[model samples]
Target: MAELRPDSANRHRTRVKIVECAARLLRAQGAGAVTTRAVAQAAGMQAPTIYRFFEDKEALLDAVAEHVFATYVAGKSLADPSGDPVADLRAGWDTHIGFGLANAALFGLFADPGRGARSAATTAGLDVLRARVHRVAAAGRLRVPERRAVELLHAAGTGTVLTLLSVPPEHRDPGLADAMYDAVMRAVLTDVPTLPADDATAAAVAFRAVAPDLTVLSDAERALLSEWLGRAGTGGDRGQRDA
Candidate 1:
């Protein structure tokens, strides 16, 4: 790799400093506190200097949210997966709840649909969730299609956190998060790792989980297999719901 030029290295460090300072302001004083002037003063730079690194206050705030959330995601991704995929999934849920509660301001920033849609860190977090769901499906524990399980878990987790955050801490139900998790798990998971022979949907889901890794299949074959399996899994889900 080519070495960074001196000017480029200094610019990078300056940008990092601005982001860190803005993040501190955001955590302590919320989004309203993270103005360009405030961040510039906090970082020991002129206000104009901030413009060199960020287009505007909105851009600076986005960077701050991404910086803090990326750190949390990095730590979360480093955890060793438990041998039991279900346990790992539960652990991930717990961690997500904890992170949201701890970083109320940052979490609220992400709660905004417009900002969240454009967030790279948010996408990375979902990628982690997708991987965990894949593991559960591969183990034959997922009753729903992997995509459905991931969406249910994500939606439930987000709603639970938002609900808890809306209430006063003193009045918040300590068990609410756990209850939501249990409900979502019931909707998505099988009781046992070994799926029933009659459960064609779950069998298709499990097969779909491992389809990409089947070396004997060509790329086109695996893609076609996955498409068929997805239809089977989702069709069963719809039928069950209708029943």
Candidate 2:
């Protein structure tokens, strides 16, 4: 067992070295440059040894993405929950955009739909976003449901990054992201004066709005509750109209 220790240590070191090399190549020249031959050469290992760690190029890229995104996320000076949830959310949004713009090459890897869905690091990032959205919900300010807000923010943020990256740096619109965020806010937030009034119809609608965001139920159960809530909210509105 003692003799096995040295071999295990060597393999771990080699794996890290290979991943680091692949990541560098990927960053320097995009995904096309991370071939096994290139990585092995960069890491001072035979091409066959590369397969000892990663099953294939996709697997290796996935590891590279996981490592890179995780490192970037860890490095962020994430803010603590504060007095204003919307301000907190905006801070997070700015940080997300900064990271994507700074790491365009690596950001593209996880942005691809085929790979993004399978990435543990991307999922972790979504969880963080969800928590931020949840803070808005907990503050009683999220006009849209929590899940819908998350989906909207994810789409808007990802789209903003990709759109900016598509343009040359000099031609890119500096205010586009802020404008998009404003559009999303306009659609998702309620003005204080026009918030739903305190009444049966309004109360039902409020309850229904959050029904889908509840986590106490399974997916099927949540779906059923959302359906029921929809009916209840509609019926309340109809009754109010009749009266």
Candidate 3:
């Protein structure tokens, strides 16, 4: 591989230093304390130097958020999944709540609709969530469509963290996160590990999970099968609602 030129290497290092310093300020003192001057002082560089790496304060904050969130995601990705997918999903939910509470300022930054909608790190984190939900579906434990399961978990986790953060630490309910996770799991999961003989929706969901691996079918055939399964799952869900 080609080596980075000295100037390019120095620029990269300088950018990383700026992001690290900003992240420290964010974690310790919140977003209000991460001004350009403060970050420059923390990084031992002139304030003007920050402009060379970042366009403005918002740009710098965006970088800092990405840096901090990416580090968290990297750690999560490295963890070995437990053999039980449902248990693993719960573990992931707990990890998410802990991360959000620990990184209040960073989590708030992500909660901003504009910032989160455009954040690459946020997208990466969601991808990890999607993978976990996919595993549960593959294990035939999921009753809802994989996408819906992921959305429900994601929404519930975010809401739980934000609610907890909104209250003083001493006032926060320790069991709130657990309660939210349990409620979401009940909505998305089958009561039993094995597919229920009477639950057509659960069967369709389980079959849908493995449909992509049905190699004997052509791509078009697989796509058609998936469409049918999706409708079947929806219909079963509707029937239950009507009952």
Candidate 4:
């Protein structure tokens, strides 16, 4: 129906307006300031109208987070991958840290595991991180499995952000974020090769990409090969038990 389009447009606009109002309140006064009545007042609407757009305060805050993250990503200059996936990952890390620092209240909300699990923005950011990690894995710079690299990066980055935010601006260590990034990088990646060498980690990383396509192996055999390659790339023995 022709009327449906106008109604949909109005609804979308109102939803965005509400999200922006809530975001402003959140940034100015923290999460406790983001009640339904406060957001409705800030948006110049009645309290009950907020319910129509978002099921509850939690859902509304999630929208506010996505709005803030979308704006941050929009302002970022997307880097061109210059055939060096490790460098590319490093650049992405800086941008991520910058975004988190600039938006502390929003970051705090998403840093909480329970709240973060409910955030679409957090999930989207992780998806971007996964792509970056996969790029490194595909380029053979990663000495660990792609899954392990992703986990390490996510954990380290989030931990760094939370740590930085826990301290006040004047007292925060200037090099802490970079130091943490380098530590995680050392664990995840190997030096880029300039010439052929007997790097078992590199060999395993390169082979892992093609392991699934090796039709000679059955499903079981392919799975076994994958496990072996993951451990090989990690510079550890697959069969060894940790003490």
Candidate 5:
């Protein structure tokens, strides 16, 4: 391996120091408490030296977010890709929740909607999630409706973690958190039908000619038929259906 030059290595070390300091302060306190002076003091450097590495506080926060995301992705490499989708989903959920629990304040700041400069880091994390979804889907681990399933999984995981973090520490119950996570996993992954609505509809159309009595109607006909069925099932007439 080629050796890193002294000046280049020093610069890299300094940059890491600044980012580490920022991450520490933001995590211990909050983003609002992270100031240039505080970070410089934490890093044991002159305040002006920070400007040499980052242009402003926003830039520093963005760098910290990117660092946090990179560290998260680097640490989460499970070898069991051939597992059941529910198991894979549950594992992913645990990893996400563990990160949030470990880095509550840091994650809050990184995910804050006000942190516009950190959008790139957020997007990068989402890209990693999207790739994971594709991998699981290609392996037939994920159910159909790949994009929707992936999005719902992401939403459910994030929502559970956030809910856990929002509870006061004194009142929080880890059992409840586990319950919520399991509930979301069941609703999002386990019980979902293998044939998505779109695919099912396409299948219906493909078999329509063979079984016209099966009613492979277009959207308008489907809506009308649904209303009619509702009325007929309830012993109501066309007037009630129209109503």
Candidate 6:
């Protein structure tokens, strides 16, 4: 093995420290509380040390969101790849629910609207879902949309997940959550007609180019968004009654 460079090792350690600090702050007080200075203090490093690894707060937040989301996706990634579309979709949904409930802080951080384009987790998750829809549409299991399915799904699913996670314990029900999600997916898939081969491919390409900026907002912005989402999340009796 090659000898390790001191500079490289130092850089790696600093990056890890920053991420750990950011994660801790996000967990304790939500994403809006994570600031460069706060994270540096938490990690026992100087604020400037964080800049050596991340260009700015947005980049650092993006990196943390990516790390957390990757863990979430890996836990739910398909294993068999047996070409069974429905099973694959269900597996993905189950993984999503499991991860969201277990890592609510991380989940909400990514889902917050203010992150703009830096939120790689939200972007990649939607990309994954869109790809699945494309494949299922190809095999005649689902309909295509006149408009892009990805955009529609993003709006609908984001609102749903945020709402579901905010439900009070006494009002939460896992079975109902799953059923509602299934129902929504089914309805969308049925109502929208599939595109022809060329159109489907084109639509897929367009969506790929329209990747959402998934960065979490500054600590202040996240606090505001989280508060709003928390309130909006509690208003529904729909599927997330127990979420």
The candidate, 2 or 3, that scores higher on TM-score is 3
| TM-score-superior candidate, 1 or 2 | 1
Which structure among the candidates has the greatest TM-score?
A: 3
Q: How many collisions per candidate? A: 0, 0, 0, 0, 0, 17
lDDT for each candidate structure: 0.89, 0.77, 0.88, 0.80, 0.64, 0.61
* Clash pairs detected, candidate 2: none
Kindly report which residue stretches of model 1 are placed more than 4 angstroms away from their true locations once superposed.
Answer: 196-198, 236-243
Stretch of 10 with least lDDT, candidate 5 = 201-210
TM-score of each: 0.93, 0.77, 0.94, 0.81, 0.67, 0.62
lDDT of 2 at 224: 77
- TM-score (C-alpha, index-matched) for candidate 5: 0.67
lDDT tens digits, residue span 122-155, model 5: 6666665665655544333332233455567667
- Residue-level lDDT tens digits of model 3 in 1-243: 889899999999999999999999999999999998999999998999999989998999999999999999988888899899888888899899999999999999999989999998889899989888888888888887888888888899899999999999999999999899889988999987555576878788788878999999999999988888887777745433211
lDDT of 6 by residue, 49-159 (tens): 888889987788777877777665554454545576656766666666666666677777677677735665566677677666655544444533312444555555556
All models, RMSD in angstroms = 2.8, 6.1, 3.0, 4.1, 9.9, 14.0
In candidate 2, what are the lDDT values of residues 104-212, reduced to their tens digit?
A: 8888988899898887778878888887776665555656555667889999999999999999999999999999999998866554412446333333345655666
Worst 10 residues of 2 by lDDT: 234-243
The TM-score of candidate 2 is: 0.77
Candidates 1 and 4, the one with greater lDDT: 1
lDDT (Cα, tens digit) per residue for candidate 1, span 121-239: 99999999999999999998888888788889999999999999999999999999999999999998888875557577788788889999999999999988887788787774554
Q: Considering every candidate listed, which one attains the maximal lDDT?
A: 1
The full ranking of all candidates by lDDT, starting with the best, is 1, 3, 4, 2, 5, 6
1 or 6, greater by TM-score: 1
TM-score of 6: 0.62
